[model samples]
Target: MAYVLWEFTILGFDPTSFMFSGALIAFSWLLVNNRMMDTEALGRDQLFYATHDPVILMDAAGRFAGANLAARDLFGDEIPEHGGSLRQLNKIGPMLDCLAATGELNPAESISVGDRVYDPRALPIASPIQRRNNLLGWTVSLVDITERERSAEALREALSRAEAANRAKSEFLAVVSHELRTPMTSLKGSLDLMFNGVAGDVSDRMKELLGIARRNSVRLQKLIDDILDLQKLDLNTLNFELQDVEPTEFLREVMRDCEMHAAQAKVRLSVVSDDAEGRMHVDPYRLKQVVGNVLSNAVKFSPEGGNIECSLGATGDALRMSIRDSGPGIPENAEDKVFGRFNQVDSSSTRASGGSGLGMHIAKILIERMGGAISYQSRLGVGSVFHIDIPLAGGVPRQSSPPCDSVPGDGEGVPAFGEVRG
Candidate 1:
C-alpha cells in the first residue's frame, strides 16, 4: 500500500487539521495518480488544494510533477501539466533544487517570491515504481509570512530607537551633572561662609536665609548625584573596592553618619543590636551607599520624636543588618516594589516621602552585585524594618572582578571612595 508524503504545517494553519488532511492526502495521492480515486479521494485532494498557501509537488529528479490550485494561481503560467523542473520557478527554484540535493524535507529559510515572503516546507514520499518512475517525490508548501516578518522588523526598529533614546538621556544627565555640580558647590560654599561670618557679620535673618539656601542647594546637589550614580549603574560603570570590614562597626558608623539627618527630622537614631562578630568581604563604600540609602528612607519616614533602630546580627555564615523606623508602615504586598524606582507606596498623611527614588533602586542593584540581598518586613500600622544580608567567608576575597579605580577608606563614618594614587 502506497501512502502520501508527510507534509509539515507551520504558522497560519491549525496543526490538528493540517495533520489530519496530510494523512488523508497520502492515500489520496496514490489513488488520484493511479486513476482509481473515488469521490472521497477527490475530496481530500480538494482540501489540500484549498489550503491558503501555495503548494507544489516535485519528483525525485527535481522535475515539477503537480501543484495545488493556489500554487497554479500564485505561479501562473510558470507550471505546466508537469514538464518543467522546479528550478524554473522564480526565486524558489534554486532553493528547491538545494533542498532536493540535500534530501532535507524539513522547513528551510524563508524566501521572497515576487512581492511577498514565504516560509517553505518540504515532504518527501517513497515510490514503489522506482525503476520506471522517480525513487521519491516531494510535496512542498510555501506559507506566507510577509506580515509576521514585517511585524518583527518593526519591533526590532522600535527597540533600537528606544535604546538610543535611553543612551542619549544618560549622556545628557552626565553632562548636566558635571556642569552644574561645580557651580552649585561654590554657591553652597559661599552661602556657608556668609552664615559663618567669613565675609562679614551676618544678622539673624540673613543667617536664616543663608541656611535655607544652603539646605536647598544641598538637596539639589544630592538629587544630581543620585541621577549621575543611577546613570553609572545603568551603564554598569559603578566600581567596587572590596575590603575586610567589621560588620558591627560598619552598621554603627552608618547610624552615626545618619545622625544629623535623623536629628533634622526630629527622630532619635539608635543601634539596637551588634551580634555580628566576624569581618565581611565586601566593598565597604558600595555597601555603605546601600545602608545609607535604606537608613535615609527610615529617617525620612519616621514620625516626629520617633525612634529609628539599627541592628546587626549573625545568621549562619551571613550577616544581616536591619534598619527599623517608627512610622506608618508599608502596606501589604509592597515588599517587592519598595526597591522599584518611583515605586508607589502608602502615601497617607503619616508617611513623609523624600528621595529621588533612584537611590533605592541603585542600592538594591549594588547590594546584589556585591553578593548580598536586600529585603524588608512591615506591619501596616506598627513600623517597617529593611534588611541587608551578605555572606561572610571569614575575610576571604569573593570576587575575581578587575580592580576598581578606587581605594578603601579608613572604616570611619559612611565612607567615600578615594582616588587610587598612581
Candidate 2:
C-alpha cells in the first residue's frame, strides 16, 4: 500500500504532464475566443465594403492599414494592398499632411483625391488600453463633393445674371429721366416767364390758372428728381459728404423749414428734443433730406386739424428721430411693402398725397447711406410713427454757427430750379 501511494504522488507531481495539460486548456480557450473575434471582424468588414462613401484606416505613422470597397472604386486596383502611406493613394498628400498636423479636420473643407473634390473627415479611434493611451490612429471618411461644387458654380452664374439685369434697368431709368427733364425744363422756363410778366401782363384769374400749371410742373420735376435719386442709390453712385452737425439744432431747422407746408395742410407741427445740446457726425444735407421726407410724408398723410410731432433724442449709442402723425394709419398687411419702390400703402390716398410712390423708398436709401436706418409703426386708425435710427458719436455741441441755406423755393423747402438741375 505504501509503494502504491508513492507512485500515485509521483503521477500527480509529474511536471511534463502538468505542463502539457495547461497548454491544451489555454489553446482551446484561445481557439474559441479567436473564432468569436473573427466573426465580429468579418461583420464590420462586410458593412464597410457595402458603404458608398470611401473609408480608410491608418496606423500612427500615417501608413494605411485598410480601405473599403468604395475606395477601391475611386482608385481602382492601383491602391497599394498594405502598409502604404495614404499620401501614396493619389493627390491626397496635402490633405494627409494637414490632418496629421491639425489632429482633426472638419468635413466642410474640400480635398482633392485623384481629380475629384473629396470632403474628408478624420476622427480618432479610442483604444482599449487603460489610463488614456496615446492616439493609436484614425479613420478617414471621404465624401464626393462634386455635386456641391456644381451647385455653387450654378449659384454664381445666377448672381451674375441678376446683377447684369439690374444694371440694365438702372441704365434705362437714368436715360429716361434725363430725357424727360430736358423737355420739362424748357416748359418750366416758358411758364415762369409768362407768370412773372416777362411775356405780358395777365389778369388775376389768368394768373391763378398759370400758377396752377406752374405748381403742377414743379411737382412733375420733383417726381423726376426722386426717380433719378433712386437710380443713383441703386447703382451705388450717390456721393456721400460726411460732416459733424449739431443734432438738436438740425432737427429744429428741419421743423422750421416745414412749418409753412404743415400749416398749409392745416396740420399742427411740433418738435420735441431729448437734449438741450447734442451732436452727430453725418452728411448734413442728406440727413436733413431724410428727416424732411419723413416729416413731409407725415404732414401729407395726416387729416386736417391733426397733430404731427417730430422728436429727437438718443437711445443707447444710437440717435433716434421719430415723426408721429394723426391720420388713417398704414394698412397692417401693407407695412412690409411700404419701403419698396412704387409700392403705395394706400393706393386711393396717393392722388391726394401727391407722391410718386417713392418718398419712403428714397428716405430709406438716404438714411442708409448716412449709416442709419428708418422704420415705421402704424395702427389702422390711431396714428403712424416713422422712426430713424442713426449711429451716435456722443459729443457736446460745437460753438460753430449753423450752415447757411444754399437755395430754396417755397418755405416748404423744395429745391429752387437751379438746385434741381444737379
Candidate 3:
C-alpha cells in the first residue's frame, strides 16, 4: 500500500489545531506553519503559511495577496508581488478554474511546472449572509506530489505485467491439463484390464504393482482435472447452467455418487433430509463438484466403521445441507485457512490425506458464485460438520448472516451430528 493510502498526519505546530494531511483542506482545515508574517491579516492566524509545502493567499479580486517563505522560494518571480492576478500564473490558474468548474480535482490534472508536479488544493474563504453569500478571497495550497504519482504509475505498470503473466500461465495449464486427461484415462483403463487378466493370467506380485500404478494414475488424473478447473475459475471463464432444484432430491442424487467411495472407506452414510419440496437455484454440476470434494474429504478422514450423516433443512430462507464426518475434528482456529488455496492443516510429508489442497478452496469459490456459502464447525474429540448453504430460488437473500461456527452441545442455531433437532 502507498504511504498516502495510510490515514496519516503531519503534526501541527500548535497542539490545539488539526492538520489535513491525507485529505482536502476545506475552510475548517486551514492550518498555518506557525511562522509569523508581515502579510498582515492574511498571515495573522497562521492561515496563509506552510512549514515545508507552498501556501498562497489570493484576494477576492483574483490578485495575489501574499505567500509564505516556502511559497516564495517555490514560485520565485511567479509569486506576482507586483499585483499580478491569478490568471497570470500560467498552468496554476487554469487548473484552479477547471477544479472549481467540475467540483473535482482529478489526480491526473496536477500542475507540472518544469521537472516537478504539484497538486493544487484551494478553498474559498467565505461568510454567509441573508441576501448573498460573501466571498473573502481564497487560500490555495500547492502540495508536491511528484514522487507519489510516479510510484503509483510504476505500481500500476507492474500490476499490468503481473496479470498478463498470470493469464498466460493459466492458459498453458489449461491446455496441458486437457491434453493429459485422455492419456491418463487410457493408462488407468489399460492397468485395470491387465490386472483382470486381459493379457493372460498375472501373478499376485504383478497384480499388486498394477494396483499401485492404477491408483497413482487415478490420483494424477484428479490433479489434472482440479488444475484445469482452477485455471478456468481464475480466468473467470467457467460457465454454470443454473436452474431451480429441489433440496432433498438434489442431496439424494449426490449421495449415490459418494456411496461407493464411502463404502470403500468402511464408513456408513445416512441422510436426515427434509422430505418436503423446496427450491434452490444452483448449477447442478458445480454443486455436485462441491459436494463431491467435501464428501471425499470426509471419507478419507473418517475412522473405519464410522458414520457420515447428511442433513437438508432451511437455515433462514436458504437451504442448508450439512455433511457431518466421524473423524478427528479440525482445530477451531483453522476456519479461515481451511479454504485457502494450496493450504493444509497437516502439511507434513507423513500426513495421512493426499491432495493438492485445492479442493476446499475451489469448492468455496464455486459455492459463492452460486449465491451461496460453505462453512464448518468442529469439536476436537467429536467430529466436524460442513454446512453448505444456498439461497432458495426467488427467495430473499440471507440478512444478518450469523456466525457459521456453531458450538456443539451448546444448544445453538444448529445442533451437532448425532443430536436430533426438534
lDDT of each: 0.75, 0.74, 0.76
Model 3: residues >4 Å from true position, as ranges?
Answer: 1-52, 67-81, 95-109, 123-136, 395-422
Deviation in Å, model 2, residue 91 alpha carbon: 0.5
Which of 2 and 3 is ahead in TM-score? 3
lDDT, candidate 1, 90-161, per-residue tens: 878877888778787434789887778999988777776675645577888999999999999999999999
- Candidate 3 overall lDDT versus native: 0.76
Ranking by TM-score: 3, 1, 2
Q: How far is candidate 3 from the true structure (C-alpha RMSD, Å)?
A: 15.4
Cα RMSD for candidates in order = 14.5, 10.4, 15.4
Measured by TM-score, how close is model 1 to the native structure? 0.74
Mind giving the per-residue lDDT tens digits that candidate 2 earns over 366-405? 8887877887666657666677876555553333221211
Model 3: pairs clashing at backbone N, Cα or C within 3 Å? none
Provide TM-scores for the models.
0.74, 0.70, 0.76
Lowest-sum lDDT 10-residue window in model 2:
413-422
Best by TM-score: 3
lDDT for residue 123 in candidate 2, whole number 0-100: 79
